[model samples]
Target chain A: MLELIVISTLNGVLFGMLLFLLSSGLTVIFSMMGVLNFAHASFYMLGAFFGFQLTKWIGFWPALVLAPLLVGAIGMAVERYGLRNTHKHGHVAELLLTFGLAFAIEEIVSMIWGKSPLDYRVPALLDFPAFTIFSTNYPAYKIFMLAISVVIFVALLLVLKRTRVGLIVQAALTHPHMVGHLGHNVGRVFMVVFGVGSALAGLAGVIAGPALVTQSDMAASLGPILFVVIVFGGLGSLPGAFIASLVIGLVQTFAVALDGSLASAFGPLDPSTGPSVLTDIWNVTIAQVAPIVPYMLLVLILIVRPMGLMGTRES
Target chain B: MRKLTLAIAVIAPMLGHAASAEDTIKIGYIDPLSGGGASVGEGGLKTFQYLADELNAKGGILGHKIEIVPLDNKTNPQESLVQAQKAIDAGVHYITQGNGSSVGAALSDFVTKNNTRNPGKEVLYFNYAAVDPSLTNEKCSYWHFRWDASSDIKMEALTNYMKDTASIKKVYLINQDYSFGQSVRTDARKMLGAKRPDIQIVGDELHPLLKVTDFSPYIAKIKASGADSVVTGNWGQDFALLLKAAADAGLKVNWYTYYAGGAGGPTAIKQTGLDQQVFQITEGFANSGNKAAMDYEKAFRAKVNLSLWYPRAVNEMRMFKAAAEKANSIDPVKVAAALEDLKFEVLDGGTGIMRKDDHQFLQPIYISSFGKLTESEPFDEESTGWGWHLVSRIDTPQAMVSTTCKMTRP
Candidate 1:
């Protein structure tokens, strides 16, 4: 039982960190621009596909440097041409534009790379087992993913707290009028933040691509789940996002880890003796019920703590 | 300048002659080229290309070079109809596709309706990989030729295997929550109930297609249910992901996957390290050592610059070629008639005999296992690992049961 919990918790943390790498950028962009970038996950998909191509051409190290840079440039272009034009039409318009961008990007990805999961293998350097927990060897690639995510998170925090551009960005996020009066280029700040956020998503994609499956539809699959995380965390709170990401991740991981039927909790009702419904529902498994954990958590959180943990305001 | 003018003068008559020859027989290749099903569809298209090239190289079919009009369905049923209509408009006599069962059902209905509208220009539909039994059984059309086994037939084989292995007492049924999954689950339940009444169905879980990321919960449920075996009919990345997650969670039990042995077989094997795992029922394709299978794979890989893993697509192309040859002409009606009467040996060493009763090809199925990779010489270098493992080939008689359709033969 302890072993299961330990393994599940570790897996949850690893996955939560990945979600944070994606959500952090999204939250920052949302905080600054007040426009939810629906195409964020698409950039992540681009990162994975681009990384795969780069790795094949040059190597993993070069791919690690170049893929996110390419995605960042693409993100900048989308912002400059697509999102900026739609910004005048309110947040809804911006959201709709991003949604269209997502659709177009997915089609473009399919066209260029084809609609198949790329055989994206983890680099040979990080191919060995990191460590054994409960007699199961966890791969070094997962550990690398966890490390990169943590480093990014810390670096982001330091930049926000200590750096000049970060300070101006923070000021713009909180007091836009004051930052403008101070003669700071708030538009440039917004663009830079969006670019960084998008690059972060791309980085996550590059790291997670091989671990997960790298395909055209990978972004679409993750998009909704990421939305759920951001919403559950609160609209613009990074800490809240972090907590919610971990909570959602753990809920799912732990749900899968724990093995028991709902019937077992209420005592073993004999199928032949019990009602037809009870009999029909006999031998139901916990894994079967795992996917419902996040939705259940979302509902419970909305009801009990509308603001969410560490969140400033209700969504 | 004189040489250029002379070159154009020489090419002009040849181009005119080529254009005249191309106007004879037009065939449509409808498959998903840009969506989730592109890998399989693209492969099918490549095989079609190979057959077209081969046929044209061999002095064309009946003194007319075959012109294949390719259309991308993008894996959408609605899009498939448009593509089918486009093919029809482009004067394609014969059309072949049906990557997904839903797509096939939609296309089949459209073709049937079109045939009624234009009785003279009826297009022949050759389905490659839509395994819904309704296509051949309830929805059997005169213009349609199903080239793969139905879900019911596949489940029969699977349940029979389970019944033979009496050690599998409690079973958990899980599949993608869609038409294909529902069909497999229903048929499997009926077959299991009829054959092995003693085997208890502990759990039945349905996950949405391409949505499930973590399968640990499902694995836990299977473990808690005390299921001695797990049965699924999931295809592509979903199957590979689920199997890997299950294996990682130490849900060590017999897992019988219907579509796991095709394109995603090697990935699943490598992911789970299930080299010693027994009893997997893969669809018939490249496993059967025959000229058609080898030649199709070689040609397809060369043309597409990708591996030929999806065997059903390859078989579909081979079936199309056979039908065209049998007809001795590219006329839709003639080809349809020929397909209904086809009893030629396919590249897979299986006798691909399309029954006049239902138009379902009675192809051979192989039951293989993941064996130790050997450094054996003379084997193709491209073919290595457990993917090249040998197991007993379940001949056509053992693989498929007889169908009961009383239709007029060609």
Candidate 2:
């Protein structure tokens, strides 16, 4: 029991760190622009695919830097040429634009990647087991994922707190009109934030490609969960995204790890009696509900605390 | 007078066709031609086209030229229904589909309903690869004929092999949380329990269908369970991602799967370097040691630029042709009637019977694994150089399990 708990906690933390990497960017973009980037996960997917392509030529290390940069630049172009045009149309239009862009990007990805998973493998350097807990070997790639996520988190904080660009961006986020009145070029700041946010997502994708199989529908698959993380973490709050990511990740991982059955809990409840809702409920085990835990939390959070765990506003 | 003219306009085409009956027999090939299932669906389309060409070269089926009408469903059930309706509107009475069982179930139900409502315009749904089991069992229809082995049939063959393999003692069950996945889990547990009562069931886990991005947490549970083997019915990315996670975690366990050779599966398997540890049960694989099958695959690869993932597509096509010839008619009703209890030579040198009970095809099912190519092996998946070698061959007698199909014939 102790070993299972230890392993499950570690695995949860590792998974949470990756989720933070994905949701942090989303939260930042949301906080600054107040336009939820539905294509954020799609950009992450593009990062992985681009990283795979770049790795084919220059290898993994260079691809890690280059792929995210490419994705960030693409995100910036979309913001400048695409989203900017639709900005006057209201939040609904922007959301719809990003949603449509997500589908379009997925289609383009399918066209190029052939609707099959790329053999985007983890680097041989990080392929070995980091350590084994009670005979369960944790892969070094996962550890690297955790370390990179932490580094990004720390770097993001330091840059935002101590840098002049950070203060300008922060001020612009709160009062874009005022920042522009003070001659801070708020548009450029928004564009840069969008780029950096997208870059963060891309970096997450680059590292996550091998860990999670990089397929065409990858964006669609992980995109919803990333939204859940941000929403649950309190939309637009980086710290909230961090906490929510861990909460969801840990909830899901620990849920799967749990072997509790309703039958066991209720003392030999037979389900063969047929056609009863209670019977149906009794038949379900914790493992079966693990995937829905995040969404369930989202629902509970919205119902109880609309502002979210650390959120200032109801989004 | 206007109503008469409208009726005449609708009747004009039928009258024109009656005067000079169509020369070509159209088979509406409904499958995912785009989106996630595109690779597999496109491959099926190519095979069907190839088979049409092959049939046409030999004077077509019953003196009519074979025309394959390809429709893209985008792997959605509602879209498949729309495509099916369009195919029916195009005067097609023969349609085939595969890929997703959910889509298959929808198409089958739709075809059955359509056939019941419109007698002469009834379409025969020849399923090439959707193997949900219930489609043939409780939900069986006379209008539907499944050419591929159902999930339960495949699982039976798989568990039968596991029962004999002494290395498999502690087994785990992990499947996508859906109707098909549920069926796989239920059948596996029942079959394994019956086969090897001594084998301990370590863990049974069901995650959301196709929604799992990472399988590490599931793998962690599997590791904790101390399972020596895994039985899963995950296809597409689910299957590939599961194996990738297992490989990354360095989990040394035998995998008995239904679709470990799906698109991108070979890449994952190769990355893992599992060699012969992973096993898959299918009607036929890329290299099953038959010269004719090998030649067919070579021509198919050269033409389609994809490994023949679905050998049953060839089987289904060939059987359709044979049934048409036997019936001496291109009418779907006549062909479907002729297809019942029909036995024909399969691609890999074996006879397959279209069982009258459930309209299910029973053929020699091969259990294969990725390993070093033997002298007889001809092709590999995704140019991996590591072809799937035949591990065990379950003959028709063993694979032909009883079904609960009470199909009402028209």
Q: Whose lDDT is greatest here?
A: 2
Per-residue lDDT of model 1, residues A1-315, tens digit only: 666667777878876877787787787778667878999899899989989999999999889989998888888878878777887788899999989989999989988987766667778898767886655556777789888878887787788778987789878877988999999877777777888888888888888887777888888888888877877898777777888888887888776655577676776776459567665365455655667677777778788888766667664
lDDT of 1 at B332: 76
Per-model TM-score versus the true fold = 0.83, 0.94
After the best TM-score superposition of candidate 2, give how far the Cα of residue B404 lies from its true spot, in angstroms. 2.3
lDDT of 2 by residue, B295-379 (tens): 8889888987888887888888788888888998877888998999999888887889999999999998999988778878878
**CA deviation > 4 Å runs, candidate 2:** A270-272, A275-277, B1-21
Writing each residue's lDDT as its tens digit, candidate 2 over A42-116 gives 999999999999999999999999999999999999999888889889999999999999999998998887777
- Candidate 2: which docking quality band? medium
Give per-residue lDDT, candidate 2, residue A84: 86
